[model samples]
Target chain A: MSRQRSMEKILASEFVSIGELVRLSGCRYSTLKFYTEEGMLPFKQEQENLTRRFPREETLVKIKEIQDLKKQGHSIPEIKERLAKKM
Target chain B: MKELSFAQNFSVIALNAQDSLHLTTAKKVFLRCMAAATILELYLDNGFKTEGDFLILNQEDLNSPEISRYHKAVLKTLFSKKETLSEQLPQYLKKVTKLSKKMLKEVEHAFAVALTEANALEEIPALLGCDLEYVTAGISMKEYRSNSELFSRLTESLRAETLETGPMTDEAILMLWLLRESGCIHDFFSREELKRVAERIFELQGSSSLAKQVFPITIHKTIEMGIKNFLKSKKDVMSTASGSGINFVFPVIERSQSVFIDTEKVFANKEERLRDIKARLESKGHIFTVIREGEVPLIKIDNVLYEAVPSAKLYRIPVHGVRLRKYPLSL
Candidate 1:
């Protein structure tokens, strides 16, 4: 296996599973994945398993902040940029 | 069982009474109205407008051996001999009807239906004199008059009781019951139940669909109470965006139809009242075009036309003891 791929598997092992992320974030699965795909939320993929994981602390805080911004009627792209600035 | 519109069924019973039953015109109309109310109660109890609903009004369907005999038995009670010395419907019906022993259980079921409808009517004070007594007694409802005068009193009492109990009002309870009166839906977990349903109507509706946002309750809340009191916890009077001030309408009886709109509670602004009335009427599937005749605005509900009563927001229909006059049925 490539060294970079090996590192990703180890990194993914440290991150929270999708189920745990959903519980902590209070957001739905598709929603969380969408945010992650848009690069708005931090997540990792285990190289061989193809399983996704959320970097627990940062992802939860980011999602909660995103939800607050959403309630304030911020659009998705706007939320992504705003969170990027905060990070 | 054959499918007959509510209007047709009402007309059939009225004609039956007027011609063969030896009922006076007034008595005939009343008999028709009471029969309509009983059928509507059946329709509502089964989830209004659902298939297999007990809406077939033909005598043949009422007595059809294939259908549940209990429903037939109830229909017989509605159409049977007029005079009875006994106030008790079951005893009186038992003596007169010549059904076989095999159908006795179904007859018992029909009696159960009468009991349930009577109990429901009693709970709502306003629904009192829709003439259930005469109809249940196998007599004529037209002998009595419609009881619309008690509107203000019934509304006041309902409101007082409602405000006293928040998030669980009488009207709200009735609203859910109104929405799902059919005993078909016994367990109440609105969202989850919808998910389990094959068609999934709950999700299909828009997010703000009042039906969805309002009716959800914990399973315990439902299981703790009887079906009558199931959605009492989801309290909110369902009102239209305009026209009527609140969501209370009284029944105006007809042969096979009962129409209700609180003309008395017309919205303060005439324009708003017009808007509200049109919106409410249209939402309930009535077809009418608002127009000015001789500079006076009017709403035509089928053949019986209505112009606003001068000074009040209510329609200018003659009411007898709060019941809409029989001649031109608003229904």
Candidate 2:
């Protein structure tokens, strides 16, 4: 399927790209990358391009969780540690 | 015998004149008179022949107090020269006429001062009127009714829809410019006033729910207007504020409302009526956020999530989510 079709498919079916995830969450690319590296996110890793794609529902929930943590005054490291504990 | 008597009278007169003359005396007196006449002529030509003429002259005029004193000294010197010039009346008269011309020239300076003052007085009223007109025009934006007539033609040229999308009305831009020009933006708006105006405008627009979205714009405008007015009043505060490196903090949350809420109400009930919520919050561990120094009641609360309804009733729901969202609290 074309990229547009793939995006539609993700919107219609399951997952979205890292870039689209950043735009939707209003979070920075580096922050998303950090979350991904820290295992704060659940995503499918492409072995060929090393690209990450996240399930839309799970990504949104994680983003909300991050926001909640921020509101609770948890620093990024602390939030990452909590997420690690949860994992 | 009668002819002899006439000749004797003439001889007496001549003798008296000769006694008064000290060689150059006549010439000096004549020159002084000529100088006076020349000055008078200049004054007349300038239409400043009367006492008003003296007022017209600048500091340089011979009639001015300073110049007059100098002229008096020169007159005394001329009188002393009289004795030396008396032997030749014509020569003395010539010198006097030349001195009068120079004196008149100096006296004419008063006319210039008078004219300048007159011009300034005449222009001041008109200038003041123009300034008031500019300010009035600036205050009335094109969106405002009073400005309709002024901006009607421009609106017609562009069409209403295009004009709205194009750029801000010139009046709005000019208002900003005038505020900037007046230099009042900082001091005129006390932190309280900025917050007040911002809140008022937001309330008026029913945008209280979008506090975050509305604050920056409202505060910016409030600051602009405040600074403009402050500059108009103090005229020097702008420079002081700029030099002192002052930065104003306009919190996104309205501080004015915080004063009335109880100290224990901020976090008490996340979703409940105001009074009940306050009671519940106090029961819990919620604490008021102190905003102002020494003001026990000045506290910050999440107004968006929670709001006051009827008497002793606070609702902990977004305004849109509430059953009735009429604002400004009509009693």
Candidate 3:
């Protein structure tokens, strides 16, 4: 019934690939890769195929937070600092 | 049985007459409706199709219920299916739409003329929000009596052209012709005034060129003439003073006697010689200045000084007559 719960259900039902995530998030594929490389986002690599995958719901939330911080004029270092504080 | 046959024949004749009349009227109405529809189609294609598309209906469509109703249905259907209407409709529909408009208007006018007493014709113009005056103003009343007459002339002129040439093209041509004939094109400016302005510009350009060529020479000539005139005036003044008994005396002691010489005659002769020299200087426009001491005078000519004694003797002297150097002269 809640908006967040409904979004989580949709994400769990859909197997959104990296390309789909880029399209949905409106972020560049290289930017997403950089985020994963920088440990800004948590992702997984398939054992046999070596393809990168992300938990759709968690990645979407993290992307939304990052976008919000950018809109608030936060520098990447500031964002990392805030993320570290959260951790 | 014979009377029954006659009645049947009469009925047949009546039916034929009615059918012919209906067909004629229906054809006219159908044409007008088609014209109105075509206009609406044009408006839509041109992107001006709006809620007031019905305003394009001709006089006949407004007058005849059958025609007006048919036009209304067509418009409704057209607009409903506008999203799917083929772009080619405008091309194909132009001729039929024009023909229909002409037929409908002709029938409506005829009907109005026939049923004058019923005032049926007046209602049609009123419904279309047009009067004879309004329609006349829309057309060139000087050239044509009615809208149909104007349109016919247009059609005749453009008969060879394709339907892609719109009605506006003809109207634009008519306007251009009228404007040309009325001499309205000359309202911009008079050609004679423009010519005069051009001439003035050329004259100014020539004057500037002449000024540029001759200005420095004129200034140099002016300075030279001024200096020559000043020198001539000074020489003339000196000559006049020498001739008017304004005596310039220079004292002389004879070196042979070591005493004053009886030089009155020599002084007079020296005065005459000085007068002659001053006259020559004046004629040649030579400039000089005179320096005077007690009973002696020195004349400066071109920055060189000359001393004249009472006798017929003269000598070149220094500028201030200090006698730094001297040259004796022949009498």
Which candidate wins on lDDT? Answer: 1
Write candidate 2's Cα lDDT for B114-184 as tens digits: 22232311111111111112224542211001122212222222122111112222222222222222232
* lDDT score of residue B146 within candidate 3: 22
Global Cα RMSD, each model: 21.9, 36.4, 45.8
List candidate 2 segments past 4 Å from native. Answer: A1-9, A48-50, B1-331
**Which lDDT tens digits does candidate 2 get at residues A7-77?**
34446757766655653565655566678777889988657434456899888888899989999999989
What TM-score does each of the candidates earn? Answer: 0.24, 0.23, 0.19
Model 3: how far is B309 from its true place, Å? 89
Give the alpha carbon lDDT tens digit for every residue of B133-242 in model 1: 33345442221111222222222222222222112222223322222322223222245433443133243223323324223422121332343243222211121222
Candidate no. 2 TM-score: 0.23
lDDT of 3 by residue, B1-331 (tens): 1111111111111111112222333233233333333333333334232233222323233345433333443333333334323333333233333343334444334333322232211121111111112233552111001222222322222221111111122222222222222222132224653354334334433544422221221111234335534543543333332421222232121111111112212334544445544443443344556554323445564344544343322435211111101112201
Deviation (Å) of B98 in candidate 3: 42
Better of 1 and 2 by DockQ: 1
Q: What is the lDDT of candidate 3?
A: 0.35
Q: What share of the true interface contacts does each candidate keep?
A: 0.00, 0.00, 0.00
Clashes of 2: 38
